[model samples]
Target chain A: MTGLKKTILGISDMKNLFQSLNNNYSIDLSNYALSSLKSRVEDFMFNYHFSSIDELIHKVESDASFFQLLLNKVLVETTEMFRDPEFWNFLKINILTRNNYQNELKIWIPECNSGEELYTLQIIIHQLNLQHKIKVCLTTLSPLNIERITKANLEIKKMEINCANFERYQEEGNLEEYFTNKANSFKLNPEIIENAEIISHNLFSDKIPGIFDLIIFRNKMLYYNPSLKIDALKILNTGLKPGGYIAIGIKESLDFPGWDQEFTVISESERIFKKIIRKEE
Target chain B: MSYKYIIIGGSAGSFQTVTNILASLPQDFSMPIFLCLHRLKHVRAGFVEALSIKSNLKVIEPNDKEYIRQHKVYLAPANYHMYFELGNYIGLSTEQAVNHSRPSIDISFASAAYTYKSKLIGIILSGANKDGAYGLSQIKENGGLTIVQDPEECQVKTMTSAAISATNVDHVLKANDIIQLLLKLQNKHF
Candidate 1:
């Protein structure tokens, strides 16, 4: 066979593999941007020593656990603690401290993969001595993510950027105060995570347990297709209380048509929005 | 060949070059230009401001899910990898940094190569790392036009050289020459 023909055949087989995964798992990956998904699936295949997509599918069909592992690879990306630290400062001054002075603030961090964002929030709340005044629920798609978060396998190297971010916040005291250093990874002090609960929740389908004063749906929306993004935004709008705030990734925004009717942009630079019209119960 | 999008990737010493190219483009240049440059995550925001100050074309860091528009330059925001969406929109990802860099050039270029296919023009400018090489190669493989800044003229030649070695690059021009080529393309078919 010609090299061009071989390449074409290989591409078709790979596409078929992803199609099969989507069909069998009932997870809609058709909406995912193809290049990143293809690259990720290639990485997954390489890691498992499967030269062909068919081999990988056979393994997936045979073992339930392998399928979960593949989902984890394709769905979640590695996240950092205190990513965009200024946003945290904005949250503290503008959203968190201002409202709910009398009651415990309910913050739901949906798509909280591996708990970095939630842990960052927890640490800041601790720093502000607001642990008693806040209840945080962190959720991911799989139990494996929850376990990883619980284990807190934070690489020691990331401390540099995390520390730099903390320094930018101009917070008093050392960043090390929040974490207990282990051999390779630093685990956040149990006290910091004590007020937080981690569980499995699919952002696309699962019903949120309760409304939140601050719903952090950061970075996760960037992965969704147009229809899925609209649906996810609707779900987030539902999860937020009236006048509640939502902070997305700094690069992200609430810019779709009629999005302004649901939420008002409080800080465009910081990507913070306040719920104006609450979703009907 | 005509192109729908012009994508450029650089790191290290390439920011100045990017701004120079942006400054040179005509106000009515019709292609949607996308830039992926390596930057620190915690640097908050300043890139768009810096580029906007020098460039004639409207320059802004695109919001995730924002629709793409012509005659505008969209920069990959710090700490996120940006890509093209199917419905003529921009998408961002918090995926693991490739080549130890977020806003990874490879991911952006590959996605553009896939989305725009032959209707993509990818350029690699001056940089110290090989981050953009694989992506440029992907663009070439997908039948898109790939250009690399002449390593001799680059402040740091590593990245451009890497790109040159990775693929049969369509053009090896200095930043000034690249601007000329862009203007020609803009006038010819755009």
Candidate 2:
């Protein structure tokens, strides 16, 4: 009966209706066009004073921008620096230090949500002292994500170092100490931002622009349907250079479509895969 | 004939599934029960709590070079793996995910099959992927009784189905029923 309840229910119903329509039409929601459509519903929901979610959806179908806002709300923002320590170790050992991508390393960290992963990679680069040497092109599914990363402020600086994770880092000789929170959270420097070219692209619809040396798109396939995972992987395969590496979140794998066959295990436990394409002399 | 070991693996819904299996297990049990569950990155040192909830066997994640003991449950710490070794312990590797799992069931099961041979009883339980299928089959190849949770009865069937499809499973049971199977096997020289 309350306005909040009405608004929530309205959004859910609208999403349900939208999803059903897409399903009926065999629409692939992974496409970039869905972003605009999602926004339209989000905008409609914002204006409604509906008492339930179902009613809110009914009221918001006509208005634009509501669904986008709703999608933002549903976005999962949970991430941490060096979320998995061993994987980074595997990267530092098996790929970063071993490979000659120093001046030419083009890393694409898709779905760089909430700046945690971006900062994480930055920490790795800083540790390896490759910040200015290697160029990393970061990509996200939403423009909002890029904005969140570049606009990352002093609030992050105030955060404290996770002593446990910091201890596990490869401890390369002659690097700055682990990050300290100045206040609120860690304040990121513009230099880190400058080294990385952040972009927004839909992996399922739009093509990934450049050839990448290492692709770390953690948790990319978790939100999608199974078919989308295969499609995304194909695109990823095309963009990655021969002998490049790709890392997924701990939960995801390339089993169904046999993507695993394309990669040699760098660290099978950390989900690191090296593209080992054959070349004829 | 003191060569029985228990191996269990899962993801997504593994935390709760392990709690049930460990609870069903008795303390001071004669055989060693080794467990591996695919965890999110940086899992806390909370495994002992889950294992202590029901079993008398002490539970803890293995250190990088730690030795494994009988009547104790050793969990592959987050981002690391647990492999069975013959010189009185399981070898922990900082290896990457085998089949998308750091503490891959297949890795643990395969190693157990190699070390324990017919004395091992491998069980594949709830999990999202097919990590343990091949490893369980390896255990079966070496003359061990292969027990898989019925895909229809599992909380998540992918791992169990992979196991069933890989080899002729000896027992396909539910979560609670697995405890019965364990007890049944333990009575026979374990």
Candidate 3:
């Protein structure tokens, strides 16, 4: 009810922004779901005090630093440690413990935004003393995010929620033992990601890094349009080892055509699927 | 104006009211009804079942990018913000909560207003928060029909009163009257 005016983004304005970003920076966002992208763009403009989309596009095209900032903002990091504690608990109980791998258990975490999920997995592995047995590859779209996460920089404001979620995840250890308090932020224990191979990789355009036993791609596809989602799913399927498991956000579903033939539902409620290794492959 | 979509937002003390509204609608309701209410972040199951208990129509918590279907009632899923995407699809987001609520009422209402324009009908019901106020106003601005439950009859007046203060709502009626109006609209179309 406050007298704050919102700058609406018309369909034409969004199309222009997408075309410009693709042409200038090779940042193709045309495949992203329109609603989420529109909201993100509007939020970015509001935060940066841009009254019009043209001004925002001009700044993005002109300044490298601003463009980098925009990339960081556009890749949403609205995630927390142990998010959906039940899902993590299910991962530990049903997925991780059930697998018997002959080789080191390889896991791929695509788009490790803000590193909350990364740290959460690492903590679980550390708790099980399976650090040597598990090797995790963490990929993200932003190099700046890599720098930030590698430094273990997490906002202090998130501590309470993160800690509460950890409790809900039903872990025995104290969550506070992993963080070192600092000014306006907290540092996650550097040792948690010691065995993690972190790199900058785009899921849409980049090559599939390697075959893996598990792919934790939660919530990443929620912003993608249906065709883009199918494309990404095909890529993930290509990147998974035979019988490898894939887990998406609990609220998300892989209901596209031919998906059932390629992947079997491991846990319908948790959104985990296992690749079907056909006789020909 | 004939509406293609009907969106209702409520919180705190509005569940029973929503159930009553849904219960009154015929099985062949012409337009899709979107219900965006505040819900627990963790409790994902059973909400749709509870909402569908008394209603003749099917209720679903739509998956991300799911295609929209007429006559179905779509409840915003837990821990995710639901959006009325272009191309008659539903888009979900894990963005930070607005007004301390995920499945935010304002986001859904505003998105519906944007997508359906004058062919949308938005209603605000009993609740303790002001999350849907600006969204109802946006619907009004976009030439959609706006309504609020009469504050005097609300279980909690804060939300409806806030909506009334935010825009020139078309109707401020009790729960039964709101149901009657919806039935009339349904009769007019079908």
Candidate 4:
């Protein structure tokens, strides 16, 4: 019982420290200011709560699982397959206008939480009948995603009936009857899932794999600190082929530090940007 | 008061969120609604049929230069944003994410604030990011009506709480109650 209280108090203190750190980064976490100002470090004398936030940080210092745990607790995983219908149509009609099915186009989905958005991209390619033509790759992993993949890939060449509920990518309601149901819920046609590759990687910690023709990192940026966001964007821009397109969540953007000049937004409202390839110096 | 248009933002349970709220409205609902949920830059899917089947409003994945027709819903067509030019054609943008969001609640709300002013109704629903707080305030500042989902009804209140703390919101109601309010606004004096 005492241990639980100590942990809670320790967590509260860490929240304070992290809050302060956030404020320092120019994110106004002003609400905690009054409490922080009133409680001096001396007030912590009676606090048997794990020394300080520093102690907790030390515990997590070498914990590779810390990030994995952080992923499960913090990331948002609510995504549907082929979210915006027309944008897929737009891509077919406007950008990939050529009828050459033999030309290989590469697409990337960064920050692909639990593989829903990545699989959804393949569904779009399938829906547009562009599947046989392009190669799709996904990078990024949240704890929920890693968990989902670990669970999904466990013990079967394919999913079981109940696994449908976990396939938030296949979608739900009204459109349930629109597509063939597999593994249970509205299963994304197996072919679409097969067309794309989902991998575990971090834009912040890992190397930006290679140049691609397109990249999508939707809704994942809003959660990042400004500097982290900038770093993520810089790495993303570096991974883009000269004319590669980069897409972010409806709310995420490239406007950050280290977000050096590279891409211009294709449509500001949709959060789609095209890599603006620079000329030689 | 009646509005020429309405805009909404949300995340998490928002998949069923918009459906549950809008399904109760009339099939021929006369007002135009531009829906902007927090979504990715990947090819958009499922929104049209999911929401369209629930509401009588003609849900469409609008194209660039599509007119903002009355009695219709304009879904952000994916990899793009749905914006208005003073009741003119609804325009699509591939602009950078604002507050790290595309189909940004802020962008849509800001555009409405910038263009429609008092004639717009801006709403904030459930989600994780602090995306629409400033834009909703802008709508209120410009004489437009502002509505926020009651944090209690939200599956995740962090998003709405940010907006609530950020702005002096005009109405805070449960998700169902918000639907009731919108219906009332439709019938009330403009």
Interface RMSD of each: 1.9, 16.2, 0.9, 13.5
Candidate 1 Cα misplacement greater than 4 A, ranges: A1-19, A33-35, A255-257, A277-281
TM-score of 3: 0.96
Residue A126 in candidate 4 has what lDDT? 61
DockQ of each two-chain model: 0.65, 0.04, 0.85, 0.04
Give model 4's clash tally: 28
TM-score of each model, in listed order: 0.91, 0.54, 0.96, 0.45
Q: Alpha carbon lDDT of residue A281, candidate 2?
A: 83
Q: What is the lDDT ranking, best to worst?
A: 3, 1, 2, 4
Query: Over the stretch A198-276, how does candidate 4's per-residue lDDT look in tens digits?
Result: 6777666678766788787765654444445566777887788886787776545467653446667677666677777
Put the candidates in TM-score order, highest first.
3, 1, 2, 4
Ten-residue segment with the worst summed lDDT in candidate 4 chain A? A33-42
Proportion of native contacts found in each model? 0.72, 0.03, 0.92, 0.00
Window of ten residues with lowest summed lDDT in model 1 chain B? B39-48
Model 2: per-residue lDDT, tens digit, B1-190?
4446777767756667678777777775767777777776466556667667776678876543345666788776666556664455545543335686777777678767766789888887778888888788778888888887777876677888888888888888877788786777677763
lDDT: which candidate is best?
3
Cα lDDT tens digits for candidate 1, A9-60: 1446656776777778876676665545666787777666676777788888
Which 10 successive residues of model 3 chain A have the least lDDT summed? A1-10
lDDT of 2: 0.65
